[model samples]
Target: MSSDDPKGIAPPLVELPISTADRGFYDGFSRQVTIPAKIIVTLIILWAIFFPVSANETLSAANSTIISSFAGWYVYLVAALIAICAILAIFPQTGSLRIGYAGEKPEFSRLSWFAMLFGAGIGIGLLTYSTGEPLSHFSENPDIIRGAVQAQSWDAVRPAFVYTFLHWGFAAWGTYALVGLAIGYVAYRRDLPLTIRSALVPLFGKTMSGFGGHVVDVVAVVATILGVAVTMGLGVEQFVVGLSRVGLGDWLLNPDGSSSLPAIALALAILVGASTLSALSGVGKGIKWLSNLNLGLSFLLLLLFAIMGAGLFALKLLGQGIADYIGHFIPLSLTLFSDEGPVGEQLVAWQLDWSVFYWAWWIAFSPFVGMFIARISRGRTIREYIFGVVLVPSLVCFIWMTLLGGTAIALELNGSAGGTIVNATMADQLYATLAVILDPGTAFAVSGMIVVLLMTYLVTSTDSAILIVNTINGAGDTEGEHRKHILFWGAALAAVVGSMLVLGGIEAIRITMIIGALPFSFVVALMAISIVKAICYDLIRKHQGVPTTAVGVAADKK
Candidate 1:
């Protein structure tokens, strides 16, 4: 072992070289990583297109098997990830470690950084689920199913927010933070590529440079595509609903009230086309501009709720929700329900649909979102990155859920909505609640604004994913010159969402995402272990008067 090896415990900080060479068609792509990932994604898209029924059934069966077998594993893994984030942030040694070279400043301003973070991280979810999730939970949650509180009653409110906050809170963002922290640490300090395999260096070391690394990158690419496809599928459903509400056309919806396949295809085309263009403009310009715009619109929408809706009730729910969320965080995070009896089956099913599904989605999404977080989060300490990436966005989600979802619940309680908000389709709840709160003209106007906001969020998310996938495929090169690659991935993403929507609507997308997330979840667990090991070893190196930070290491080499 070298002198820096320290009893052969610390893995050598060797940079794994990833090649991006010109194959005739796949020019500027990593042959091993990009080719395999493309083959897998293309096969899935073709399957969903040609054999829709078979693909749907297979996805459904696979989702069932995974959920039933790995529900507890998912729960504990995510909870442990959150715990790892907490430990990293609370400890002085790890928390104070900069994400980039010493003296490096943040690339984006705090406002822009936060806006992009929200937009790329969970903006679609806030719009898609802020009203729907809490309202659904208000009607029935694990607590309600267990008879701890009556459904849709005053007693249901706290429990509803508990589960809502649980899904959207630290646990969700911690998944992303841990991945980002790992990648940023490796990429900046150790001079490794900013890809998923880099985060596993401390664990697998030189093995990451071979087929093992390519497998990790391929999994990340596939997971990112499916994860973003889920968001796109759901967003398109709500986008169609918003269009119909704004007097666009009834053709946007089928008779049974789902988004029509034609409408979904058109929306996907528009979104992916726009996203491809924005991605060509690169992260610094197009994404930042759109993120800022959507964040402003989000604030406007939230302000409308604060003005016209039940502000005091939402405020009260916010306080109690935080308390209940804290009190029940442990149980909610780690609890696993058995599918043994009627009540047990109901609880387990609920967990699968809500908690487990959210965990899978976030884990799958971490590659894209986590890499985006790391790209924008250079120069910040681990504590700051955790706070900004996990805590702040989560608190914003809580406030959003309280104000929007709380309004829907309050309207139901007061009978002003007459069950319309609760009875409407999930995609239609936000507009339904707004109509109940505002006059028809005002509701129509606000609905138009929401559609615009939704469009921006979708564009931001799609573009960000396109860029991140390209980054991984190009071995972490973020150059904006790869327009062809961007366009190809954009079309691929559109095809994925469109074909899946045709196959089984959002359900197909959800099942595929859950399945895709499973493999990557194991990767994330390894990442958590790798980061802890790296940090501890670096601290030991520091105590032994060796260089640890990027600057120190660079200077020592000189």
Candidate 2:
């Protein structure tokens, strides 16, 4: 029923007719959503497996076109999402609005909440890129390309972090925060299903309950799978490399040093198996414990670098990098270089490779991460959720990049590593850095620790993703007793990653992820608009003295 308001005033919330029924294998699943999503994902995986070269070439071409055509869109859309989040947090009326019903408290402790947030959102990324990204940018960024700084020199350090922080900072998390806030606001406050389609109620109304809704959820599911697959694919590569570094044998490596098929298969079997079991255990027990453990291990690793690596240099770089990142945030977030000439071409290509790629990756990844954040973030105020989701993890990532990547750069500067760290593959840079900074015995021991940590991160990320995917498919029935669905998704995810790696290595995964992210980016843009509209309408209801809180309004109706 509509609230007692003027004819022109909108209802405080619209409850959609979302339905899920028991299917034989997919108990509590929304067949409309899950069936199509599975079909599309299966088709892609089969294409890659059956026609490897064709799939790789098609994906590459599609990736190039999307980057060239939509680079500016990705840049501006992500930047705007961050601005939207900031506005919601700063505006007193919206900021103070709680995510859940009145008087409700958070379901998770602050530490647990933060741990899950960091672990699920960017855990694998930090391990994968902390050393590689910074070192790559330190050697050459847009500033270096533009002749504003000398590569690998003192002049390059600040700019290196400027770009590194750009990729991992607020913009990345803002995408997640906006989506999470939108879903949480409606799902928790208005008692709607916690699916991607629910966030679009304000924009589409009842249309979101029908074919339109299924389409939205399907797109989200596909995006989530591809997004998580890319991360898993990257993690598997690092996992295998970590295995080789710790004496797992050259059988894990090919003649050219890439991961062998056996390595990929073994990594997937372990990761997916662990993740599936964790997903079956639900978010509270398995996911929470693993997140906390990984957080602890992460701190231990960071402490190792702080004690034995370039502590002073990393500290200095941390401060300067943060400052430069803040100073140049806006220009970097919005600027899209054009293809004018050789230099322009280089800048555009770099932006496409780095900034645009990161934006797409974050967007693709946002559905899973955002939904997970929303799932765990009940009872938080809009302000708290935005800040907690966007700011905290980002700062943590900055510190990680500075400490781990800064150590590598410092070693190179001081001639201790003599380019060994930089020369190592992106997946092996962390090991190389550890080797240079620690004694042989100590390095081997720490490398073993890192391998374990990487496994935890990979498992945590994969399990969290599998849970989110099933949540969407189940029409937001997060606690559904559907171990079969979880198991199926885990296998499917492994297949996707394994086939893509076999097809075109990590490059194929990257290309496909970028393409998958494109459609969801549009969905996210709509979510931003819908949440703003819903919040604005809620403010109007508050002013008019209509009960705006879900619990209060429900009591009145009773």
lDDT of 1 by residue, 1-558 (tens): 333654644333757877668556657778899888989999999999898778977987887786679888889999999999999999988898888776778888899999999889888888989789988999989879988889999999888888899999998899999999999888888788888889998888878888899999999999999999999888889988999999989999998889987788778877888888898899989999999999999999999999999999999999999998898889878889997776998998899898889999999999999999988998898989998888888899999999999999999999999999999999999999999999999999999999999899999999999999999988878773678778889999999999988888888898899989999999999999999998898877766666666556666677
lDDT, each prediction: 0.89, 0.89
Q: For candidate 2, which ten residues in a row score worst on lDDT?
A: 1-10
- Candidate 2 achieves a global lDDT of 0.89
Cα-based TM-score, every candidate: 0.97, 0.98
Residue ranges of candidate 2 with Cα displaced over 4 Å: 5-10
Q: For residues 1-558, could you state the per-residue lDDT of candidate 2 as single tens digits?
A: 246535546455546777777557666888999999989999998899888878877887887786689999999999999999999999999999999887789999999999999878888888989999999998889889989989899888888888899999998899999999999899998888989999998788888889989999999999999999888988888889989988989999988768999999999999899989888888889999999999999999999999988888889988998888888889888898988966998999899889988899999999999999999999999999998888888889988999999999999988999999988889999999999988888888888988889888888899999999989998888878878778888999999999999988888888888889889999999999999998998888777666666675676578
Q: Return the lDDT, model 2, position 348.
A: 90
lDDT of 1 at 442: 95
